[model samples]
Target: MNKRSLRTTLIAIGIPTVYAVVLRLLFGIESWANLFSVMTVTFLFCLPTIVGALTVYLSDASKARKTSYRIIAPWIPVFLFFVITLALALEGWACWLMILPVFLIAASLGGLLGGYLKARNMNNKLSISTLVLLPLLLSPLESMIESLPGTYKAYTYIDIDAPADKIWRNVTRVMEIPEAEDTGYLTRTLGFPRPVKAELNYEGVGAYRKAIFTNGLVFHETVTEYQDLQKMVFNIKAHPHEIPSTTLDEHVVIGGDYFDVLSGTYELEKLPNGIHRLHLYSYFKMNTTFNFYAGLWGKWIMKDIQNNILKIEKQRSESM
Candidate 1:
């Protein structure tokens, strides 16, 4: 808690905190459930800079620069702990990503310490190295965490009584759909934002349609390929977060905001006693900002579609 140590603590804590506050004030806006607000606050509160700074200040760097492996050689346990925690928590190989970068940082920082200690022939200098190592590593790591964009999801299904052939007839007929009323307003399937509208000549591939929203959220969904009852594949413009740049080229539609395509099959299967299954898969990404709270809004909206189909199509099941 001496002058140098206190100064180190303030610098580590202050810089990250000030940046967090400024960013939040300038650009961070809270959505439905205040998910970003809470996450942003929590992230800033745990800024690791202070911890790394203290480690550096306490070490006797006078001899710190001389030592070849002064801190890292002994701190293998600490490195292993973070690595293990990351691996266990993150899905797939994402966890291990943090480890190598941190290790490289340690090697360079601790290597510098190693060189210093070797030159001066100094003894143990634990404090300074510990502080310097993590900041050199953790700051970049933390920034990456903050920048990752959230993901969204949605699902909808419809059952038809007539043969699978009849169902396929109606599925691809975009113009044939009923004007989405108070309820049928399914995903991007309905109202379709602003100047953008479904192209009337959209008989097949290469069809480009746009949906514009007032809040600067426009998305474009393009039809890549189309075939009879087999499959329909489409590509959406990348999510705002998919790239380093923030402002998307234009807010045409809710491609990622809502799903891009509604795909299904014209096949038969067993649903119940003497009943055939006309199974279908609606492909689309939910158009909504995800946060810890407020749950999944798009999914809830889609649940209505499932209920609608079951309600509208229920009479056919009973009649059979």
Candidate 2:
């Protein structure tokens, strides 16, 4: 790249990133100005869009000969911002992974807007300044609007070749799961604690069960309804205070302010030809301004975890 291009690149990427860092710190402060929050739509969506617009506007890359280049170029700086924040520990891996898609898409859309403004020879200074300050200007108003909590369910099942009794045994009390048997792709990729074992004192309603996982995470469950070899329902609780802080990002932590698991159920239906289908389902809650998006991820992670357990149960029951 030429010196002029290099200078433009540095200015475009640097200014927006520095602005983002400052905003992040300011929003994180617990003072009376708590309305400026990182969890709001302004920060998640609007900030990145502004970053992309600034990048395209400053770089003048919007005038590129290739339309594709103009569209895709803004993402480079936004991705760099992600890398820099991750390296600085300003953001956690799980949070970044969840927000990466949103950032990239929003940035691209902003790039398109920036290109349009440039093509029309609009007042670059005025437009860029407004875009840069948009998130800060809107965050306070957005924060005043409370986020409504939403409840969602994740259901998964597997057909076991074993008898209903054997499936029930495994479902009621999951044995110590070896690492090789764990098949939870999403949770594992996000560094979530792996399930180790579950201990149930006895069968029937009112019984208590402790589901233990790595990194000192535990789910306390109380059986609310029970039917021998047919179905079992339990209310699940994971106390955030009791969990190790390092186990999960605070934003995505189970039973934390933003997300939680409420209850779980297991059902065994005897299919034809002596096969038993085991169904595992759980209810989770997401209390975020972006529950529509966050809830999708919440369901995916829950399904992955539940499916992994069901797979293990199926393997063990069939082997017996």
Most lDDT-accurate candidate: 2
**Candidate 2 lDDT by residue in tens digits, 89-161:** 7788989999989988888888777766666665777888888778778988887888999999999999989
lDDT value, candidate 2, whole model: 0.86
Model 1 agreement with the true structure over 18-122: per-residue lDDT tens digits? 432343343233342233331232322222223222333334444244344344432332344344443443211321231234434543454454444345545
Clashes of 1: 30
Q: Residue 4 in model 1: shift from native, Å?
A: 48
Over all chains combined, what TM-score does candidate 1 have?
0.34
Worst 10 residues of 2 by lDDT: 61-70
As for candidate 2, its clashing pairs are none
Q: What is the clash count for each candidate, in the order shown?
A: 30, 0
